[model samples]
Target: MSKKILVWFRNDLRLHDNEMLVEAIAKSDEILPVYCFDPRQFELTNYHSIKTGAKRAQFLVESVAALRQSLQSYGGDILILNGKPEELLPALVSEHEIAEVYHHREVASEETAISTQIEDLLWKQKVNLKHFIGHTLYNKEDLPFPIKDIPDVFTQFKKKTERDAIVKPCFLTPDAISFVTVQDWGILPELSELVVNEDIEGLSQDSEFKGGEEEALNHLHDFLHTGEGMALANASLKKNEIVSKLSPWLALGCLSPREVYWKMKEAEANYGLKPYFNQIVLGLLWRDYYRFMFKKYRNTFFKPEGFKQELALVPLADSELLHSWKTGNTGHLLVDAMMQELNATGYINTAARQLVATYLVYELKVNWVMGAAYFEEKLIDYCPASNWGNWATVAGVGNDQRLTSSFDFQKQLKIVDPKGAYAQAARA
Candidate 1:
């Protein structure tokens, strides 16, 4: 009997630097790749927003479609299904005689819960489930300090890790995959099937961002070689031009952070790491910090108080206020413009994100979780740790040492968008 393995695709969607996929290929005679579109992700949240709104749903759809195509090119096909993994995997194992399941480990509470449920189910069938870490720039084991001892401050964590920790080289993409035949490789779900709003088409059509590994690599190359690299390194540079805009692909695991890190290192060697390349590495470091924080804090990271009890009164959710913020009708030019851009393109630069989040939590006085939840729905690159952790920090409950943090929208507008180019473009 041949050893048949199932590669479960989750947040880590790309083939390049995919450890789980490589492991499956090495250990099994036949591999079956699978992706599940869990219905729960598309449901409404407590904040009355669809958990996965149309913009993100469309991106996800595009990503999965690309994954399937990539697999097919390797002479393998991904069995894309619309169901919970726990309910679906057991049947797949039984039908295909799958001997093992391999996947990337997810530390977030909800993802961990689902993984645990699937593990228990697979265990009952006497099949093994293996998990590998592929999300962060640095492996947890390679970190200079233990996860529990990871510095609560970003600068402290950044310094130690940059000085002491080592980033392992990325895994190789397989040349060809030997696939086990799957009869019911279901079709990718349409936006309407995912319960996405009809208005998404109009919003996404004008947006240049597309979801796929190919696109991710292309963006990386363009950013590094084509002067976009220099823009990424300069903090004083405008958001529209300076940032790499790689977060969406990174968030979806369509691109590995390790690949990004290595590429940036190459650029640094040639260009010198003074401002441009150093800044890019700093951004990757910040992402790793949030992931480690999630591992250390777990579900507490999502709470309004966020691993601390210092906040006396977390704001209650206000439907009208949230609606105004979400719709970009809050009457603050900069905040409204950022929100409009986010709603339409499912993306915004880090500065814009911080400004809008600060406005929602401070000026509008709405609960931070509501704003976070909305971001979860809207962002093309929404990673649980980075999104919620940043929200908590801005909400005065996370790792920031300061008791309160708020951005001055007008002041930021003057500095970053003096002539209001961003605001004007967003409105247009």
Candidate 2:
């Protein structure tokens, strides 16, 4: 008899170049795909907003639906459940007699805790739990320096890995697996049910950032195979649109970095490499480096005293200033506009993020952790390590040598958007 396996889908949402999915297929003839909405993610935090807001929830629902459709074409169907994994997975394993569970590894504190607990639970049930790193182009075990010994500065980390680390090739899965009996469950929660206080402007945007494996794959084809590659690369370097707007998908695991990296290599070999390729890949390195830092430093990443005591002067929180910044009402049009864009779409460009954080910490003297928590609630691309690590860096708390740095809004607007195309779009 073919072995029954549960392939638990977390953030790694896509089917392409997905190591966990590939391993599950190689091991079992019949695979039951599972995705849990994970109730804790939907609940409100001390920040007084949802941990995962409506915009992100809408994207997730769309992505999960797309993943299910794709899996169905392969003789497997995605089982959707809403609850804690600790309670749900045990019931699922018993119900399906699942012999093994396969998933990608997560590095955040909460996610790591869940992974460890799940590993122990599956062990008790005698079902093998398998994990593979899917979010990074370069895995931790493949890095030159030991993860614990990873440098405390981005430049140092980047310098070491730029020369030393090699991106491993991604795994691919065949089109189909044999049919398996999945205990029929009903409809996954729609965007309306999953989100409360849906009346905000963020929910009504005409700009669509829908989820799913096919959409992400199509985006890849459009970005690389089309003429937009040079444009995006240029935009990314200048903190504009020339870059691949794939980070949200990457963050949510709708697309794997390995798939993107290989595609870049193929394009470079064909058309000659662009300067943008190296810079964008450096962005990916920052992602991996922060994840390693999080594992090494733990919850300290979220605090103002990140990975060290006596962080250079702790900035006081100015509630009035923060509220203005959050609502996009700050007098500075660039900073306010960026905040407005984020509030409306739950996503923002990397450059805009740094500028806004710089204004908050150095200009307004807002508490760093408060800003990080607000981002956690709002950003669709919110990865704990990247988000927290980045916030700490801008606030002079994380792995930077500088005592502090502040952004000059007027100077950036002139340099990055002299004609104010982005600002004009924000108004529109």
Candidate 3:
């Protein structure tokens, strides 16, 4: 009998640079790609925030649809299922006679929990669930230090890793996939079918975060091959012109960091663009550091006090202050405008995010976890490692607490939105 494999799609949604997809095709005579739209993801959190907000839900729907279309073009298709992976994968495994399952590894507690459950159940059926580390720019094993010994400070980690480590080339996109033909692959749901399509005029109507691999590649292409990214490469441009908001796609694994890195190098070689490219490269490194830190420290990043020390700068609770901050009535024009932008568009540039998040922690003296949770609910680009890790760092209890924690919001606001142009856009 031919060795059949079931490839489980988690966040690493795209075919390009997807390790599991490449592995499944190579090792198995027949392959089936499956993505589960878990109801748990759409449920509410303890903080009363929708676990996956509508904008994010919509983006996911579009991404999955695009993936299916991409797969079809390659003589394959992804099984679009609407249930928990733990409940659904076992049945698929047995029904399809799958010998093994492949998926990308995750670091966060809840995601890991599901992975563990699926592994245990698969083991009971005499099948193995294999994990590949494809999320980071540098593979986990390629880091200069092990997860436990990575530097507590970002600069230290970055310097050491830059000096010693190397980013492996991305896995090539498969030209064709040999698929196990199933009678039904199921229907992809519309955004409204997945989440309540709210009349959320509060979120940014102008923000365009298109989902899926094609759009992601388009964004990267425009950034490098076209003028938007190249214009920022000018040595004289202010940092404000460099709004590389690729996080939404990166967060969902629609685009791989290594792909971005190599492409930036390609752009440099072709255009001799200035090294503002390194700024974005450093951002990729930061994302890797957070994921590695999450793997090292785990749930401590989620706690109010954090794992380092009791960082009780203020009481961790919801109050009128938090309400004002959330509603964009905080009375600080810069902070209010940034918050308004985040609410309206499901995104804010890096400066805006730092200013507003820092304001919530130090200036308003509100609970940082609540602020992070709000970001989790609102950001279309929300990733567990980056979101909570950033919050803990800003709250001064993360791995780099020894480093300076807060930013000069006023100074930053004047630079990024000096004329209050973004503020006017948010308020208008």
Candidate 4:
């Protein structure tokens, strides 16, 4: 009898450098990969009005569909389920006589809770559960500083690890799985199946990228190997230009950071090194830092006080102002444009995220937690730690060096987004 292994597919979507998939293939005679489209994700939120909005939901469905195709090409299959993993996984395990469950470790309240319950149940079944860290370039064990004692500020954290940190190289995937067997499968739920909002929406014409590992790899090549790659990097480094545009892919686990980092390094070798490596690497580091923060702080990072307790409370913005911000009717062109982009495409550049978050907390006097929740629902790369930590830091609540301040919308419009191109484009 072949030893059955269940690969619990979560954010780490791709086949390449997929630690969990690689390990599962090695350990099991037959591999069964499963992706659960948890229904709760599409429900409405109290603050944002809509939970998973149309654009993001559409992108997620598309990405999962792409993943299914990719797995089929490699002589395997992704069993699609449309319920909570805790409720679904045990039944599948018993039916398959699964020997093990292999999955990537996630660091969020809800995600961890599900993982914990699954782990406990598997233990009772005598099924071995293995978890690998495939999400970030720097593994938790590989970090120079203990996660518990990580620096409070980005500068200190970066300075200590910049020279000492060694990013583990990527591992090549096996050519193919020996056997392909799926007992039963079902269709993915439509947008209306999970979402309550009656309005059906498509990606706004501005969205240039699609969800999938294929598009992600193509983007890496375009960003790193091609002529446009160097240009985008150059422009983005100088002023946060249309560089790479890989955040959504990176966020969705369509592309691994290791894959991107390797490609970027190779591009540097081919095109000659530039000063922007530091800036680009810093963004990658931000991703790593958030993961670390999440593991260390757990659900506390989701709250207003974050890691620090005893912080003074400020009056939060009422629902009226938050609605204005979410609807892109705040009258601040740059802020409005950024929110509109997020609403239409499920993404915003790092620069835009920082500026808009600052505006919400300091200028509008809105709670940063609300902004974080809105991002959580809409963003393609909504890692809990990164999203909440970044917002809290910007809101003067998290590990921050800069004083609590607000950006002047008019000044930001003239400077960061001169000529009102972004504003005009989003408004249109």
lDDT of each: 0.85, 0.78, 0.84, 0.76
For every candidate, C-alpha RMSD to the true structure in Å: 2.5, 2.9, 2.3, 2.7
The TM-score of predicted model 1 comes to 0.93
TM for candidate 4 is 0.91
The alpha-carbon lDDT assigned to residue 164 of candidate 3 equals: 94
Q: Residue 287 of candidate 4: its Cα lDDT?
A: 89
List the candidates ranked by TM-score, beginning with the highest.
3, 1, 4, 2
Q: What tens digits encode model 4's per-residue C-alpha lDDT throughout 1-428?
A: 88888898888778888888877888778888899998777786655555666767777777888888987787666899999998898888898888888888888888888899999988888887788888887778877889989886777778887767788888776687753366676787887786676466553535676888898898778667666556644564352454557877787788888887887788677766455455567788888887887777677766777655777765444477888988888998778888887877778877788778877877788888888888977787677778887887776666553533434444544566787687687667
Off by over 4 Å in 3: 196-207, 233-236, 313-316, 411-428
Best by the lDDT measure: 1
TM-score of each: 0.93, 0.91, 0.94, 0.91
Q: Which is better, 2 or 4, measured by TM-score?
A: 4
Query: Candidate 3: TM-score?
Result: 0.94
User: What does candidate 3's lDDT look like per residue over 1-428, in tens digits?
Assistant: 99999998889989899988998999999999999999888776766467777788878887898999999997878999999999999999989899999998999999999999999999999999999988899988888898899888888999999999998898999987899989999998766566643554453435478789999999999888766665656555654477678899999999999999999888888877655578789789989999999999899999887866644456656688899998799887768877877777788877777778888877888878888888988888999999999888777777786744355556667867888887787666
The model with the greater lDDT, 2 or 4, is 2
Rank order (by lDDT, best first):
1, 3, 2, 4
Candidate 2 — worst ten consecutive residues by lDDT sum?
232-241
Q: Candidate 2 — which pairs collide?
A: 13-253, 63-212, 231-242, 232-242, 232-243, 233-242, 235-240, 235-242
Candidate 2, position 260, lDDT: 80
Model 4 CA deviation exceeding 4 Å by range: 46-48, 201-206, 232-239, 307-318, 401-415, 418-428
Off by over 4 Å in 1: 196-198, 201-203, 230-241, 406-415, 418-428
